[model samples]
Every structure is written in C-alpha cells, then in structure tokens.
Target: MDLEPIWLSIKLAMITTVILLFVGIPVAYWLSRKQSILKLVAEAIITMPLVLPPSVLGFYLLLAFSPNNGFGKWLHQHFSLQLVFSFPGLILASIIYSLPFMISPVKAAFSHLPRSMAEASYMMGKSKTQTFYRVLLPNIKASVFTAAVLTFAHTLGEFGVVLMIGGNIPGETKVASIAIYDAVEMMDYHSANSYALILFAITFIIVISVFVINRNAVKSPFE
Candidate 1:
C-alpha cells in the first residue's frame, strides 16, 4: 500500500483547513452580524454544498475551470495557471465543498454570544477588530476548534468533487478517498480496508474530541 495517497490527503486537508479558518472566520462573523436578504442569499450559497450533490459542484467547477474554455482559458493564457486536474484545483474545490463545515459551527457560536459582549467592548473604546480578537473570539474557542477539525476531517474524505476537479494523479491530487475507491475497483480489498480503517480511526478520534470540547465548553468551571 503506497502511503503517498494518505499523505497527500493529509496535506490537502491541512492546507484547506488553514485557508478556510482565515476565510471562514471573517465571512461567518459578517454573516452573524448582518441581517438582510442579500446576507440570506450569501449564506444560502455558502451552505449549498451541504445539500447539493458533490458531483454537481464538481461538474460546474470543471466547466468553469477547464482550460478548454471560460475563466480557465483566461487564467491559462495569462498566468499559465491550470486549475482543472491539478492539486491547486483540488484545494479550490475542497474549500468550496467543505466551506459550510468550517463556517456553520463558528457562525452558530457567534450568533449565540450575547450582544452585550460587543457593546461592552465598545464602551471600553476597543475597536471592532480588537473586540473580536481580544474579547469575543476567545469565548468561542471550542466552536472554532470544532469547525477546523470538522473541515479537516471532511476534506480527508472528499471524493466526487476531487475526482472531477483533480482527477487521480498519484503523488499529486490522488487523495486517500480516491485511492480507496481505486483500490476497491481493482478488487484490492486489503488496500481499501487499510485506507478506510485509517480514515475511520482518525475521524472517530476527531468526533470524540469535538464532543469532549463541547462538553467542557458548556460545563461550569465551578462545578
């Protein structure tokens, strides 16, 4: 069993999770603070991948980024950047595909926070940025951590979207999930089982950690 696929998955998940952490934080925070039809639409778009089929997102992404036409052609001609069937494309697709996992929990946490927290910070003359980083954000550490872990785990198990955008290029875009599919197709049950079991163990641990974190977060320190 080549470990390359497993390692590639981990690398991709780590990169995707890191990127989403930065991207999701501001987006989630803004969404939490706003209330408008446009914000609702934007939230729906962000949440679309959760309900839509992975193949649907993958297909549209393929069409948009395929070097044969559209934005992909412009990117290729100008920047020499090819997205479809590449590692970078995999990252882009994963970010879109796993965005809600990173955003939803954090957004919910933000929404649940008392409005007075921000008001109190303002009374002390702290800027919104300062209040968010120094005052508000610290209170939702558990949710942020949970969102990051969920995003990482979700990326590790990606299949349809990755298959369409990245294809199965060994040592490149071939992640563990795709590798497992390939193994099963070849009737190599051993390799498939190995990949599945590893993913299972990792995700199980992640879920357990999430539960523990949430439990601790909700538990009173005095108790």
Candidate 2:
C-alpha cells in the first residue's frame, strides 16, 4: 500500500484544522453576538460550502486562484506564489470547504454562553477583549474542541474540491482521497482498500476522541 497519500491527507487535515481554528473563532464569536443583517449574509456565505456541490465550489476557487485573475495576479506579483495545483492552494480550498464545520459548533457554544457572565465581567470593569478571552472563551472550550475535530475529519475526507483544484500532484497536493480515486480508476483494489481503511481508521479515532473529550469536559468541575 502506498503510504504517501495517507500521510499527505493527515498533513492537509492538520494544517486546515489549525487555520480554521484561528479564522473560525473570530467569525463564530461575531456571528454569535452580531445583530446586523450583514451577519446573516456572512453566515450564508460561509455555510454555502455545506450546501453547494464540491465541484461548484472548486470551480470558483480554481478561477479565483488562477494567476490570470486580478487578485491572483496581484498575489503572484507580490509574492511570486502560484496557488494553482499546489499544496497551499489545496490547503486554502480545504479551509473554505470545511469552514462551517468549524464555525457552527463554536457559534453554538458561544451562543450557549450565559449573558449574565459577560455582564458580570463588564460590571467588574473588564474590557470587551478581556471579557471574551478571560470569561467567554473559557466557558466554550468544549465547543472549540468539537469544531476542530469535526473540521479536521471533514477535511480528511474531501475529494471533489481537492480533485478539481489539486490535480493529484504527488508529494504535494495528492491527498488520500485523490489517491483512492486514482487507485480505483486503475482497478487496483488492494491500494484502494488500504487508503480507504486508513482514512476510515483515522476519522473514526477523531470522532471517538471528540466525544470522549466532550464527555469529560462536560463532567469536569471547571464547567
């Protein structure tokens, strides 16, 4: 069994999860509290990935990241970076595709926070940033953990977007999902099964681990 793609998939999922944690935290916090219509619009935009066909999302990303496009060209001119069919491009696509998995859980957690806690912190003369970091975040640790696990698992199974934008470049963008596809196309059952089993095992572990952590977190006195 070719282990390379399996390793690549893990790498992709890990990087995507880390990026989503930072990006999703702020977005989820905003969505949880913001009353503006723009928040609804933004939520719709982020949740689009969950509803839209992977191919459709991938098509837009392909065009947007292509060097011919204005934004893409500007990036290329400034950084000499080419995203098309590259590892970084796949990472970007994975992050976008897996955004809702990260955002929704964290948003729910943030929304579940008691308003009284934030008010008490404010009454105690804490700034907004201080209240969020010192008060709100500590209360939502489980949700953040849930978001990271779900996002990582979802990113690991991604096929359509990675296939469309990544083009199966070996040791670069050729993740396990794409490698499995290639194995199937070649009628290599053994290789396909190996990749599939590894993916399944890793994802299963992640899901189980999330539940375990969540259960323990819920039972902890800190909560």
Candidate 3:
C-alpha cells in the first residue's frame, strides 16, 4: 500500500485544523456576543458550506481559484500563488469546508458562558483582550479541543471538495480519501482496505478522545 496518501491526509488535516483554530476562535467569540443582523448573516454564510452539497461548493471553489477568474488572477499577480491543483489549495478548501465543525462548537461553548464573567472582568479593569485570554479561554478549553479534533477528523474524511480542487496529484494533493477512491476504481481492494482501516482507526480514536475529555471537563469536584 502506498503510505504517501495517508501521510498527505494527516498533513492536510493538521494544517487545516491549526488554521481553523486561529480563524474560528475569534469568529466564534464575536458571534457569541454580537446581536447584529450582520452577525446573523455572517453565521449563515459560514454555516452554508455545511448545508450545501459538496459538489456545488467544490464547483464554485474551482472557478474561484482557477487562474482565469478575477480572484485567482489577482492572487496570481500579487502573491504569485497558484491555488489550483496544489497542496495549499487543498488546505484552503479543507479549511472552508470544515469551518463550521470548528466554529459551531466553539460558539456554543462561548454562548454557554455567563455574561457576568465578562462583566466582572471589566469591573476589575481588565481589557477585552485580557478578559478573553485570562477568563474566557480558560473556561472553554474543552470546547476548543473539540473543535480542533472534529475539524481534523472531518478534513481527513473529505472527498468532494478535495477531489474537485486537488485533482489527486500524488505527494501534493493526493490525500487518503482520494487515494482510497482511486484504489477502488483500479480494483485494488486490498490496498483500499488498508487505507480505509487506518483512516477509520484514526478518526475513531480522535472521537473517543474528545468524548473522554468532555466527560472529564463536566465532572464535578465533589463527585
């Protein structure tokens, strides 16, 4: 079995998860506190990828990232970056596709927090950034972990978006999901099973780990 795809999938998921953590955390924080219609619209747009058919998302991304389009042309001209059929392109697609998995959990965690916590911090003369770092983040550590794990697992299993944007180029865009499909198409069930089992095991471990951590987080000291 070619281990390259498995390695690529791990690499993609890790990068996407890291990027999402940085980007999603702030958005989740804002969405949890804001009461504007714009926030609602933005949340809807972020969650749209979750609801939309993967093929539709993939098609739009394909056009948006293609060299012929305006956005793609500008990216090419300014940054000399070609997103189509590249590793960074796959990572970008995975980030967009799995964003809700990261955002929703963190948002829920933030929403569940008491408003008084922030107010109390402010009363003590803590700035917004200080309150977020010293209080809010500490209380929501579990949720942050949950978001990262879920995003990573979801990206590991991604097919439609990666296939549409990545074109299954080996060692660059050929992640495990695409590799498994390729193996099946070529009637290589043995190799396919190996990749499938590895993927399943990794995902199962992550999910189980999340649940264990969540359970511990919710446990009472007295209990």
Candidate 4:
C-alpha cells in the first residue's frame, strides 16, 4: 500500500469536516427557522448532492473550475491559485459533496429543539450568536458529532467528483478511493481487497460509534 493516497484522503476528509462545521452550523440554523421560498430553494440545493450522481456534480464543477473558463482564469491570473488538479480543488469538491451529510443532521437537531428556549434566551438579553454558542449549540453535541463523522466518512469514500475534478495524480489527487479503483482496474484484487477492507473497517467504526454514543448520551440541557 502506498499509504500516501490514504493519508491524502484522510487529510481531505479532516479539512472538509472542519470547514463544514463552520459552514453547516449557520446553514442548518437558518434552514431550521426560515419560512421563505428561498429557504426551500436553498434546502433543496443543499440536499441535492445526496441524491444526485457524483458524475453530474463533478462535470459541472469541472467546467466551473477549468482554467480556460472565466472564473477559473480570473483566480489563476489574480492569485495564481489553481483548482483544477490540486488539493484545494479537491477540498472544494469535497465540501460541496459532503455539505448535506453535515447539514441535515444538524438541521434536524435544531428543528427538534424547543423554540421557546431560543425565545427565552433572547428575552434574557443574549444575542443570537452568544445564545447559539453558549446555550443553543452546546446542548446538541450529539448531533454535531454525528454530522462531523458523517461528513468525514462521505468525503473519505468520495470517488467520481474527485476523479472528474482532481483526477488521480498520486500525491496530488489520488485518494484511497481512487487508489482502490485503480487497483481494481488493473485486476489487482488483492490490493483492491486490502483498500476496500480498510475503508469498510474505518466507516463501520465511525457509524457504529455514533449510534453507541447517541444511545448512551443524555438529551441536551437546553432541550
């Protein structure tokens, strides 16, 4: 096993999860409370990746990030930043691909929370930001953990989007999923099995641990 791809995959997942934590919090919070038509549009777009084929999303992203295109060219010209076949590109794709995994659960947790609690916090003179950090968010630690793990796992196993956007360039873009894919394409079943089994074990541990923790944990104090 080269392990470089595996490490790269882990790095992508970690960074994606961290960014989504910040991204998902506000997104989910807004979605949970908003009643506007735009909220529906936003929710549908956010969740589309869950059901959309990775290839479709990847293709659009490829066009959007192509250096020949305006936005991509502007980025390269102004900042010399390349997204087409780089780690930063991989991270961007992973974030969009994994957004729902982080947002949905967090939104569900927030939705299930009592609205009166938020109102009470507001009545007591706490700003929404302060209330979220101190009173609203800390209470939903379980959902937050579940969201992070789900996002990390989703990014770890991502393939098609990564392929179309980043391609398999070894240390540059070849993640574990791409590595296993290459091994299978070469009829290297042994290598494929090794990679597959490792991924299976890691995802299994993550998913099972979430269930175990959720079962044993108490409900949030704010709830």
Residue 67, model 3: Cα distance from true site in angstroms:
0.3
Instruction: Please identify which of the two predictions, 1 or 2, would achieve the higher lDDT against the true structure.
Output: 1
lDDT of 2 by residue, 1-223 (tens): 7788888988999999999999999999999995789999999999999999999999999989889997667789999988889998999899999999999999999988889999999999999999999999988988899999999999999999998888988899889999999999999989999899988898889989998998898795866
Candidate 1: list runs displaced more than 4 Å.
none
Q: Estimate, for each residue in 78-155, the C-alpha lDDT of model 1 and write its tens digit.
A: 999999989999999999999999999999999999999999999999999999999989999999999999999999
The TM-score values for the models, in the order shown, are: 0.98, 0.95, 0.98, 0.95
lDDT of 3 by residue, 112-158 (tens): 99999999999999999999999999999999999999999999999
Model 4, 89: alpha-carbon shift in Å?
Answer: 0.3
Kindly list the per-residue Cα lDDT of model 4 for residues 72-160, writing each as its tens digit: 88898899988999999999999999999999999999999998999999999999899999888987899999999999999999999
TM-score of 3: 0.98
Could you tell me which residue pairs clash in candidate 4?
none
Q: Which ten residues in a row have the lowest lDDT in candidate 2?
A: 214-223
Supply every candidate's count of residue pairs whose N, Cα or C atoms clash at under 3 angstroms. 0, 0, 0, 0
User: How many backbone clashes are present in model 1?
Assistant: 0
Q: Alpha-carbon error at 175 in model 2, in Å?
A: 0.4
